[model samples]
Target: MSSRPKAKPHFRVSPAVLGPLGIEQLQDPALAVLELIKNSWDADAKRVKIVVDQRKAPGKILVNDDGHGMALAEFKERWLVIGASYKRALEKSEGGRPLIGEKGLGRLASFALGNTITIQSARESGRSFLADVNWEELSSAASLEEYEVKIRRGAVTNGTRVEIHDLKGAWSSDHTEFLVAHAEFLASVPGERFHISFKVDGKAYRVKHALATINRLAEGSLEMRVAPDGTPTIRKCVINGADEKRIVFRDMKSDELDPTLAGTRLSLKFFRRDEAARRLSGVLQRNEVTEVLERYQGIRVFRDGINVPPYGLNRDDWAGLEQQRTSTGGPTLVPGNSQLVGELHVSKRAQPHLVITAGRSGFADQAAVNALAKYVRWTVRALGTARRAEHLGISEANVRVPARIDEGKDRPRTASPQTIRAALTAISRSEVVRANPALRKKLEDASQAITETLGQSEESLRLYAQLASTGIAATSFSHELRAEFDVVSEAIAEVAASSRKPDKELIDLLSTSWGRILAFAALFKVVPVKIRRHRKTMSVSELRSSAETILGLASPDKVTTELTIPAMRLSIVPAEVDSILLNLVSNSVKAVAESTNRESGRIRVRFEAHGNDLAIHVADNGCGISRSVAQIMFEPLEGKFAEGTGMGLPIVRYIAERYKGAAAIVRPPASGFATEFVVTLRNVVQ
Candidate 1:
């Protein structure tokens, strides 16, 4: 029994063709970057410089390596073949190092980034060679076009160069800044002589080395990191200075170096561009670093320098993580799939279980790795959650000192940590706790005044805890707390004025401090935000005051403020009246704040009381709501300078209806102004 009849050639010879490919399909920039970097590695380059020039128009990505040059044959058949297998066959022969590039498809990566690609290589074997490919031609054809990439026999010395031009993606100021932000990864590699350069509009990329630079902008700051299974260390970092090499980690505390230091721990890296000349993780690209980061800014667990793959810090109980303050200093995992970042130092002797990767820089593909990844995700989730009750307390120490209020009432140009600290303090005090002595004293007296007012602080505290648990902020909470703080802090100042202390100057200074603190805290007041789960509050009196203020703004200036229910307060869900009030009043104020005639721009507010409802009427004598503004009052609209997001009246209407109310903008009364507003509330709350 022999095999079946001899196989015959097919009736016709079929043409073999390469499959379709697109540059846009390059999913992982890390993998694409590896392709460029690997060529240098293959050249046996001791030093390579990666430069990314993202100027105004089309950016150019250049990779130049001082490695061995390419020979003619290697350039044509081996270098240009898609999915070529030259490494396995040649490994036993020349050089004998394992090849970083096995599949030839890596060369295709340039297509994803740009349309024009050029490669230049020099060989000690002979002269340098240059090969270029225009991908537009490739992508334009219905079928694959084979272009022979041959080595140029002329010009330069031994080395390889690749430059991709005509960038597929447009460069924006944002993208340029992003590249700069990740610039730290540029010069980061230990025990290696590689340099990465980035330029935006011709300016060299740089990093603000001080950890304090981050502190300068955050409302709250905490710069701490944790390491795996070892003692941690902490070191003070002034905003723009460097630390004196006293190794610090979460596992090891104290500046004193332990001669017997062993095991894993978090290390705070202070960047010194002119000195260390090393990248934090010893990696050269942003994508490479991102590959190991958990959703949070924390890095993956590395056992002996190898990454613990799919799962990271989750499994290594002693894994590296940080608290979530302003910088990577604290542990915080925000929403969205962020870039992988941060470095966790490790060495060869870490436990076998810890070394999740199978000797490579990847994690071992086992259930443990999955568990670890999940653990990392869970830990990140816990930073703002599971640990809130505990972590919130610890983070209070990181609040920054507040800024001095300057004239003009404009907000600080930068996001100061003090701002966040003040907001937190006020929230915690009036809306959450009466820990502050002055606030505590008010609560003590409120209890003496009556039973109703005493429960307010407890209610604020209860609401605060609820917000903390759900990560939802209530708008009423801010107003309630602010008003309470304002009233209470004012009371404290009065009570303190009578104290004839041993030192009159010290007492006066304390009084000034109280006033400044109270005023600073009040500035935290913000426009209501009703994002999902967010609570926006507009109190009845606040609405009336704001509206009256705006209505009084007339060119002739006749708008004035008069409250009918001076002490009354109601909660409006959305802000129909608020929007109309803001638009009318602001217009009124603008028309009047610098008026020549209508002396005091007069705006009137009268609330007509009914059993369960009320009618609020506002009349202004300033420039009335223009037809243009009335038509689009709360709707976000695009126009010239200060063009409205148009959230005014629409938001007001939404709020009015939300709280069972109706708002209308009608033609104004005679002399003073040309605007009238009638807000009908179904049920007004006190």
Candidate 2:
């Protein structure tokens, strides 16, 4: 190698480099305007006004701000320098506001909006100055330094004004509306000291903070705080004007979490977009509320009372809420972006690791960002859990009725005319009633009438319960028998194909299928009668055996079953338990079979006992239930699949309620399973 003395050469930048560094760096014209506003904010501006005039060709836009304007020398040193980092060393402005613009490139954002820019500023105690720049001239120059900005003396003023001409795009009403909407949210909090006004063609556009309006009508509100150690605790949760119990999340102490996510506070307000919720809001029109939510429903991050761009914008799922809800099959158990408006508060000086991206669109991809997302998700989930519990409590309270008195008996008894008459007669003998004989007679007559009405109601309730039970049983039996019949039919068809003698495998398959049919028939026979008898306790192994038998008949050969039963006995009747398992497994089988891309089906059954309550979770890797379907899946004849009788889940729910428990579609466990159903049986574990 003939290596002479290597020459060190410096790279030369072309005037065309401004295209990529300035004009092309920002794609959206509105964002360019936003960058200018941010510069005003960093200058500690209290009032800024933007005027867009399109009455003539090549519209002119003016941005005026009343702030601490720059002196000529200061402007030449900072504003003229490309890629300046002076703001990087400063934490706050002279007015004690946190600095927002640091890269010094935001000034170039004006070139994205127009071809020419004129800036005029006057400092309180320094000389006023004016600077004019033509972007087209700069881009065509031989070198970046060959272009010169014309600087001259300007009228004395206390603030700055930027005049941009030769607009790139036609200005319209929609652009003004976008400015109003986005500018309203820039302050992080509504009605802050920083004020922004917009005027289009001499018409002032009013800025309404939609988030503030929605917050007042929110159905629920939650506030949480995260400690430096990564422990999160709910400070307050109010749902439907009632304070809910607090929820706590485990500490996140990973290497990427603890250092960056300390001392963050989050506040969220929930709005349910439904007619009932709208009626409760009292003043909200359906269309008006919908429009508001569509615009402002997301979680935003704020650093020192100023919003970080693009985090809470429309359709921005920075926290992965939609992904979480889809993975868990839990729209009710997890809140999506459209359901909440939240604010996350962080400090620039405190959490420097949470750096903003180069384009100012969002936070950089870092561990700190992941930690923040995780904490926000946890907060949202806690809110959902509290709201769900509140709903369940309300449902239970609505269905409960006061106990009726019986003749000299402390226990509650069924309503009857004789019992009512006896109780009213005792009341009539009181001194106040004796004094008013006519009133006493009225009371006695009313009691008899009330008792008769209640008795009819009770009879109707009994009939309804019987009908529901019978329907569930019939549906379950049909589902199981169909599977067995299919197995038997397949075995017989195989035997017929041999044409010589029945193979051993085919004979064994037919016998097993027959045995399953008999077992299922016996199980069905005991369902209605065994519910009335004293419940017999069964060991964990016995329950597993029952589940295995049902799974074997319900699942096809390609389907696999996973059981995670703890070593505990349950004080539940075997028949009732069998019915619950039979319906759940059969539904899973159908769901798996209905899936378009079926390889090998998987079903998981897990049991956990908390005190005397047993929680059974049945999950499957199948064609998952949609949120709309899950909402009404427990209702009779409301199934998503065509072959579903829709009575299976209703039956499972009915049996659980008989034992003073509940059945629900819960968030799927984190085992890659979809569509999970939870059946809770109270006082059943021993």
lDDT of 1 by residue, 533-600 (tens): 23345465566554443332232324446556544555443333444444434434444443342566
Q: Taking the tens digit of each residue's C-alpha lDDT, what string does model 2 give over 1-686?
A: 98798888967667677666766767567778888888888787888998888789789889899889888888888888877858899888888787788777788788888999999887883567899999888888887677888999877787788999999877755566556667876654543578888888889976657765687678888898877666777888888887664433333446434545677889998875542233442333544665677577778888876778777765466776644443332324556666778889898787887777657767785566667778888888777766665664432322321111121346343445565445434544556555656655644444444344434323332332344336533234443233343444333333334442432323333343444444443343334343523578798787877777667644455678888898898887776787788788878877887664255888888899899899998888888888888889888656555334456788888889988999998775447777888999999887
Roughly what TM-score does model 1 have, to 2 decimal places?
0.40
Candidate 1 Cα outliers beyond 4 Å, as residue runs: 1-22, 25-61, 76-78, 83-106, 140-145, 180-183, 206-342, 345-466, 470-686
| TM-score, predicted candidate 2 vs. hidden true structure | 0.55
Q: What lDDT does candidate 1 reach at residue 602?
A: 65
lDDT agreement with native, every candidate? 0.41, 0.68
Error of model 1, residue 142, in angstroms: 6.0
Span of ten consecutive residues with least summed lDDT in model 2: 398-407
TM-scores, each model vs. reference: 0.40, 0.55
RMSD of each: 18.0, 21.8
